[model samples]
Target: MDLDAYVAAHAFEWQRLEALTKKRRLTGAEADELVERYQQVATHLSVVRTSAPDPSLVAHLSSLLSRARNRAAGGRTGTWRGVQLFFTDRFPAALYRLRWWWITTLVVNVVVTGVMIWWLLDHPLVEQSLLSPAEVDQLVNHDFEDYYSEYAASHFAAQVWVNNAWVAALCLALGILGFPIVYLLFTNMANVAILGSIMIRHDHGAHFWGLLLPHGLLELTAVFVAAGVGLKLFWSWVEPGELTRSQSIAREGRTAGTVALGLVAVLFVSGVIEAFVTPSGLPTWARVGIGILAEAVFFAYVFVLGRQAFHRGQTGDVDASLLEDRVATQA
Candidate 1:
């Protein structure tokens, strides 16, 4: 076919192929095959039945094809598409994978929480040291009823959500330093333990669960996910696997960072629920149900949508020099 006709005939298929490739992982052989096919198609298009093509024909074709493929692969159109790509495609795909981290963190947190609870139960003075006199007095007098009411009245849901979202973002960002993630996880666990101890001491543990589970589940999960992504980065540095430390770090950074942004979104939504819906005196069963439902939705997004969205492409240009260097260096 002539260059123009070939371009016109194959453009749509190429775009679809590009999107599919971006959204799904492919083996090295498959990637090589696809790249070869793409080059052949473009070469044929460049040579036949045309007056000399534009000098920048390959570059122009690649750019146009990339944009079309991006749009086809869930990218938005227009100026804001760049922003959306940053957040949705780039950010979320990098950072969010919490199951391993959550499991590890839950064990640590639970152990720490148990120790703290035991200490507080054994030495009441620990409570005095942790809780102010006024706070203790209020707890003893069952004045938490009024305190909670006042606390609930004062904080607007929107502000709480924004604040929590900011915290999650900060955790992910700071975690690049490595140690900050451990600190953040430890601090969060302390908070949960402290709160649990106070409630258990006051014989209001059930109420506390009702109030917290509604939002705490999702909020805590997000936090753990962020920490996990950070740990992944740290491990890449320490272990390096088959990749050089730098390459591994970069790859981990991209995937873990994107997933972290998604966690921030989860935290934002959870915070809103915690501030508003969770504290509204719902029944224990109702709170648990909501928490379970939210968790289900979060997992669905992470596993199903995440896999579909961030998988590596089957076709793309490979740097010949880089491959040659790796082969030579390894040999």
Candidate 2:
């Protein structure tokens, strides 16, 4: 049959099938017939429309076919139970697809750290330029010993951490509007420059490890990750690849959001250390150990847990703790 005639002949059947599928009440025979008819109609429509069938339509048809097959094998079961199972199985998969932001953020962090390290090593004068005279005086006196102590005890640590978190969130959120991401990047770079300067000017560039290797590790890494997400969202608008800018932005936004949440968690931990540990005159070795442990944990969470969460959905391996006895036995 010609495409038009086939569409005309089956139009009412297709409409009825779609309606029944929406109601989730098709009988086995009726679903089977509808599936067969949908396949034929879809093939004909493809020729006429010169495009693939809509994915939603294909999903609906496949679902109806599955429902029919299930009914044939076993009389019936509650639809709500099936839906619950579907969501339980699929939520991880959804989360997995949304992990690109975390990965991207991690990469950005590494790059930023590398850049900061190189700048501190290569350009001492610029580092000197970055710090204020009072900061420079503290560095000369080795008085930063007390500065970290004050920071740990003061309310300022909490305020600083909160402000940083808000700024990071704003960067991610503003990228949605397209222009704010540029400003976000510039602001972040300035902050990095100031931090790098502090490390270099203090202790005659000798205390870099003491100053930054501790709390700076997680805190700076979080900042870089947040910046990376912002950059990705901004780039989505400027270079959207094959998709429309809006579509690309939306896709990247989901990943960026997850990464931002992870950053917030990092900031919370880092802030506590900065407020209480760094400033409290902890032994240098102790501070180093704490920083190293925190970084290790953060790394594992981002690279290991993050990857598993991303790919877990595709493997259909539910966490053992969440599975009931029947589900476990069936598996």
Q: What is every candidate's alpha-carbon RMSD to the true fold?
A: 9.6, 10.8
* Candidate 2 lDDT tens digits, 9-68: 666766665554454556778656655654544444444334334566555544544443
TM-score of candidate 1 on Cα atoms, chains taken together: 0.63
What's the CA error at residue 23 for candidate 2, in Å?
Answer: 20
Question: CA lDDT of 240 in candidate 1?
Answer: 90
lDDT top scorer? 1
* Every candidate's lDDT: 0.60, 0.59
Candidate 1 lDDT over residue span 1-331, tens digit each: 3556756876765664465456455466655545544454444334531444555655665554444333333322335775555544444334333346555765666678678777767777777888897887576456544433456533755566676666666665775587887787677777767767777787788876777788777877776666666676677788899999888777666656556555656777786677666757777798778888998887776556544445742111121221211111110
Residue 34 displacement (Å), model 2: 24
Model 1 worst lDDT run, 10 consecutive residues: 322-331
Residue 56 of model 2 has an lDDT of 61
TM-scores of the candidates in the order shown: 0.63, 0.54
Per-residue lDDT value at 199 in model 2: 58
